[model samples]
Target: MTISERPVQSRQDYDGRSPFPGAHEHPAASRTQVGLTGAIVVLPFIALVIAILLAWGRGIAIADLLLAAALYVVTGFGVTVGFHRLLTHGSFTTRPWLRVVLGVAGSMTFQGNVIDWVATHRRHHAFTDRPGDPHSPYRYGTSLRGQLRGLAHAHLGWMFADEPTSTPRYAPDLLADPAMVRLARAFPALCAASLALPFLTGWAISGTLYGGLTGLLWAGLVRVALLQHVTWSVNSLCHVIGSRPYRTRRHDRSTNLWPLALLSFGESWHNGHHSDPTCARHGMGRGQIDPSAGLIRLFERLCWATDVRWPDPERLERRRVDVARKARAPAGD
Candidate 1:
């Protein structure tokens, strides 16, 4: 079983108290940390504004859009396939070099380093919608007012809470891997390269500094912002909205938000994923488009990935929630 598939302790519903010892939010982030997070969160919107202004002044370059699309696919997949499935969930195995490649690519997206990202996500599964979940939208309470506040918390506010997930406790395996350790330590450099690559590419291609600036705006800042929110939406919106065709653990309100499938590279099949955390494919149902899963399949075909834990039909059938029974189920907290 994957690390995430390990048995998790059950907990009572959240009742405005700590779920575990020392579970309370830490002190507010340091000024430097807050400023850094602000840059990560707010700079993209600033880039968007500049992009709009530039669009009005001179139509957005087709080259800029294309470069943005390319980087989005690369970095986005680096998270979904690399950091998430391969590293966090152990959904498949790849050769050593590809593993480091994926790790570096994901680090560029301005998410935390690979180790911290995996640790936080593993902790999320261990606690789910309960009080211990790092980013659960149900954090505040079930009331409308609480849900609103919790949504904000889950979407981005939690980053400022400074609640650290201990890497040694949650990601010991990564720490033991020299390649991952080095890659995790190089996170800042990778992020800089992530931005610089687009600018340099645009400059090289167009032979103009203006081209490079626009590339940075759209491909660098805007791409990071868009992917960040789409991933965050899986944390905040997926739990509150969307249909739940599969039964997850009690209080685990993960849901399948289709609108996010393409943008999130199929990671938004949240309910399906929560049902079988170790499965490689999140979009288990027919007609559910899952680009990440498709990419994994491609890697497997190319002999780059193996031991892929594709969904088992019989197992899925066993986990499927009967529609009639689900209708009688009480509303989620």
Candidate 2:
């Protein structure tokens, strides 16, 4: 799972009613908890370094490279399309079986169990960059020193903090779904399978234990590390460095960082997302490649997804910064 399922109180005064459900903040994570979180963040980088060193010794296998790419696409889409778009935002409707499949695939990303993932994200939207936000890069003030520290906090530090989002308050729908509950409970097993699948496939293909080990390092650990940082960068860099083409709520600093678009499966279109959270497509502008939206379109064609929330041109036009600015200009200007 993620943090405790236990209801916890808001830690700071909010703009309105607290999004978090309970009384006082949960205690700081215990030393053992922090240690585990560190391992999750550090071990993958360690594997990446070892993989590079091993590649230097002998030319890397094509099989390992192919496996890494394949697994990365599957697991990455699992998070971007399934967890973030479908479950968290209801960007579209899908068959129950497909929902289960998507949830299972997302759980393999090791981000968190499906329930906790949905809960935490809902709370993020409810409070955004303000005080109740669980991982805003602006957690500290916007001073240069604070910005640097908050970037770290948003990128990889907040997981070690003991703050708990209330699942009942933020994600009771997921909790009520028995299939989703089972999938959430299966998170640990799904993670094991995520690592094992690559190793087993490489071993079967290459007929060697060395091949399996290499696959585990590259496709398993290294792949996880890359996805984790890319996802976290959306939380950190997307807030700090990029263009804001659409108008969002006050103090919501989400931006669209094109450099990260391809790697993030179009999730780097953060400004579009923050502006229209329920839209199936985040890449609302021309030439904004959105692989996740493409996948959703494919699902629609296959009758797997319906009621897709495609972008509304008029609504989007209204939210454009230039449009809003023009609307406020004097009639005689």
Candidate 3:
């Protein structure tokens, strides 16, 4: 049965409203929250160290490699295609069962509740790399030290802050959905599933408890750690290292880092995405290999997704021209 059907009881927990005049937050950061973020941030680094040690000593089995790859693909797409595209952007649609499954899988990514995910992501797009951008890789200005600090900030440090983005403005649609709301509330369980399922699969396949432990360590914890970095790289590395193929209103430097394309699904095509936010496919160009788009197309063939906003040649050409004009125009025209 679909899980998003539970009715919302009250608006007390809702934080979707734009605060009124004179209700400004005295800007602050919570040290406790920062410490928690530090823990989360450091935990992954330690996991990386452990993984490297394991690999160096050859503790990881072939089965663990296969299991890790399999889990990464699932959770990666859960965030890329399912969480970012389907739920956050509404670029296309999905069947009820698949939708619920995707939502649950994405929750296990340990990002946040689905509504919060969608809301924060939408706000990021709304003000990418700009002042209101919650996690811009260039927040601290254009000095080398600043860029380093900003990249660190953008990658995951911003999560240390306590000021939550009011979800009502960014994700009213998701908030209104009965099933999505319920699925969002199931985030804690989904996170546990993310970790436990890998161990269960490993034990069942290898018929050993040691296999299960490695699976949980590699596929469950370590995999989440790696994918989390890759996902955040769209915000940090993509901004700092890649090429900007398209234009955007936001002053943010979003690049299409080719190295990350396969790993991040089509999301490495960040410039195109920022330019055409509602388009179903981020890698709209011919050479771009977007597995997420392919999956969506598969769904379309099966009569699941509809109203896909595929790129149009005319519109793309115009967008390019507009970008050139903005770049080359006289300073005071």
Candidate 4:
């Protein structure tokens, strides 16, 4: 269905004109609550810097760096390929076992359980930059001070809010799936394992408590903080900055932020994604590096993924704003 024709809850239901029908009402966060939430978001990056300073003379171990890089890849792809592509958008299909594995890996990223994450993302897509969007940089207003507040809200402040997206409305498929339910329940344990695994790996490689601590510091806290910001950037900056190379449904301001391309594992190709939400490849044009797409291709080769939704040139051309503009121009020109 066209975007305009898609079903939407009444504006009053979503725009806070009325309380969400059956949803819990959360008061605005108090100063203490806001402070705590900000600390939770910021302290890790501070600790990471301190850890780097402490390791200055000794230098970070090659093993720790490698462990962090490896874990980053596994967990990052778990979000990009698994939580995002496979489950949320159905960009491709895979074996049930692989699906569970991907869910587990994504859960280890500590980005909430798959169901909640998917539900939140689906809601974001549903409203986009409109009044109901969960995290739009334009939420506050167009004034400078308002934009700054909106940026903060979009980047992280919204997480502290008591508002919750309805799982049944956004992710009923996952809610109905036994495997996904079990995986969601296992999220806490997976989070602990995500940290502990790096520590154990560091200890195993260097056989020292110091090595283990450093591993926990770098691979655990720092890695999580970095990935968290990269993901949040897509919600905040991708909507406010960067190039909107493709057309999307009205009010979707998603843009392609090339700087975040590698870090976000192709998710930074926001325009392409909003243009074709289910397409497996976001970086459809030349020199658009998309490691997530590469991983998906590898899975396809290994017979682990099937029916991949690689981009179609004709569809892409149809979606291009330039093409639409040319089509609208006078026939003589």
Candidate 5:
């Protein structure tokens, strides 16, 4: 008989698979260095200061006001309904054409592409207020100095740092779509058009070069700056200060600060969202008045969205009871 049999292999010879992707998965940050993050941050305050000075000196005009209002609503909703509640959290669904339109309009705001945005956001949710969280205000622990550092990190320092999430791992669904790829590639052009559109409209409406210039400054630059801060504030202020009326898990420090409710487009209802991440509505309580929710309802009515995950009273009741029990638990004395 054959004496040429090979030795049996050890069990340890086969390497176990890791849940994360390998080298081919993630592409590096696309040369869009966040060096401009600091510049963008500082420049906005300067723009605001300049705006105040101009307004005080009677340099403001009716067209400037109109353009500012228009851009604020457009880009603001684009981030809220498009980038945030829709794309990042999958709070709702939309039709094919609407999806492309939202992606394009959202790119005009010059936030990162949908894939990166969703990736970072998923990481944020995966480790909220924990060490690995992309932007956690609780990273430094609960001391005064630590909270200060954590707050700064949560606000804008995360962008200033180089801790980007891998899109292939966190946002494979988004990255696989060709429509999103086209929008991401065309992002710069869309942003340029966004800036120029207001100016063109102002020029056409007012029939003056000065109107176009002011529109670019006010509606274009200033608008971007303002929206950026509002979006970042959700990562910063919302974490630090808010009312946790709903029953999110104990470690999750999400709250609903009423003052920022409107500006954040129902996103300030943090506790509700943390409790049910996939539900289409964050502002689940009565009288919350979520404009984004209203828009989602419109999409559903128009057949642009199906399978909408609206809130359920029974689930909400069970959650509240669970929270109440935990709150009343006796200390281990």
Candidate 6:
């Protein structure tokens, strides 16, 4: 069925509110809470600075660079493929063990617990650039000054906001699962392990305290900070810049920024995703490199993932704004 022809559900359904539930209120963050949130965002940059200083004296080793790249890929995919496509959107189905592994790896990124991450993301989709969206560059007015403020807000300032998205209101499915609940509770431990493991690996490989520190700097802090900015760019620049080739729901102005495609693992195909959120493949067009989609395809081939929601060309054609405009135009014109 066409999008317009599909049965419309209530706002509650679209928001993923639980039918069976108590109040899922997210209270305003206190002064102390906001301070802590700011610290979390800032500490990584501090680490990056320290890493650079250390590199200035010792020089960056191949092992350090390799470790950082490897960990970045793992934790990055943990967010893109794991927290996003698999948990938030259900673009594909995987084995139970694989789900746990993905969830743990994602938690290691320190983005948030799985449940909270999914809840915030689902809420973002439900509201998009509209009033209830947790993060949107259009939240403020559209004036030049307002746009600049909103860009910063959407990019990283939103995380320091007093209020947060309620899990019960937006991720009841994840809350209902015992395994997910367990994983969410383990977020703290996973974060500690994420940093510690790299340190230990460096120490073991080089048998020196400096090696361990370098590993912690590169794989732990620098990697996390890099991923964090790349992800935030999607929220800010993806809406403000790039090409919008597909027709999305009203008020949704997601765009595809090719420069971020590789770093974000295809998530920069924001227009394609907002147009068809559940499609496993975001880079539908040619020459669009989507490593995440390629990884999903590999899993499918290996029988590790099933019922993958690969993009449909017919649906894409139907959603193309140019095509829709042509179809609606007078034949003589």
Error of 4 at 239 (Å): 0.6
lDDT values, one for every candidate: 0.87, 0.85, 0.75, 0.82, 0.71, 0.82
lDDT tens digits by residue: candidate 6, 52-143: 89889778878888998999999999999999999999999999998988898889887889998898899889877665777777666566
- Residue 275 lDDT (model 1): 96
Residues 39-73 of candidate 5 have per-residue lDDT tens digits of 66777578677767767867678888888877777
The TM-scores, one per candidate, come to: 0.93, 0.91, 0.85, 0.87, 0.85, 0.88
Model 3: how far is 120 from its true place, Å?
Answer: 0.2
| Residue lDDT tens for model 4, 1-333 | 001112333353243222222222324666776776676588778869878887988999888888888889999999999999999999999999999999999998878889989988999888787666767776665567767777887899778875567888889899899999999989889988998998888888889988888998889878888888899999999987998778886656788999999999999999999999999999978999999999999999999999999999999998887866757945312
Top candidate when judged by TM-score against the true structure: 1
Off by over 4 Å in 6: 1-28, 323-333
Better of 4 and 6 by TM-score: 6
Task: Order the candidate numbers by lDDT, best to worst.
Answer: 1, 2, 4, 6, 3, 5
Number of clashes found in candidate 2: 2
Model 5, total clashes: 0
Candidate 3 clashing pairs, residues 3+ apart or interchain: 4-178, 4-179, 5-179, 16-168
Point out where model 1 deviates above 4 Å: 1-26
State which candidate has the highest lDDT. Answer: 1
In Å, residue 72's CA in model 1 sits off its true spot by 0.2
Error of 1 at 299 (Å): 0.7
Deviation (Å) of 79 in candidate 6: 0.7
Candidate 1 local lDDT, 1-333, one digit each (tens): 012322333456444323332334345877888999988999899999988898896898999999999999999999999999999999999999999889988999999899989999999998888866888877767778778888898899889876677787789999899888899889999999999999999898889999999999999999999999999999999988999888788788899999999999999999999999989999999999999999999999999999999999999999898999888866752
lDDT tens per residue, model 2, 136-246:
777765668767877888898788877778888889888889999899989989999999998998789889998898999999999988898999999999988999899
Model 5 lowest lDDT segment of ten: 1-10
Please give me the total number of clashing residue pairs in predicted model 3: 4
Model 6, 67: alpha-carbon shift in Å? 0.7
lDDT of 1: 0.87
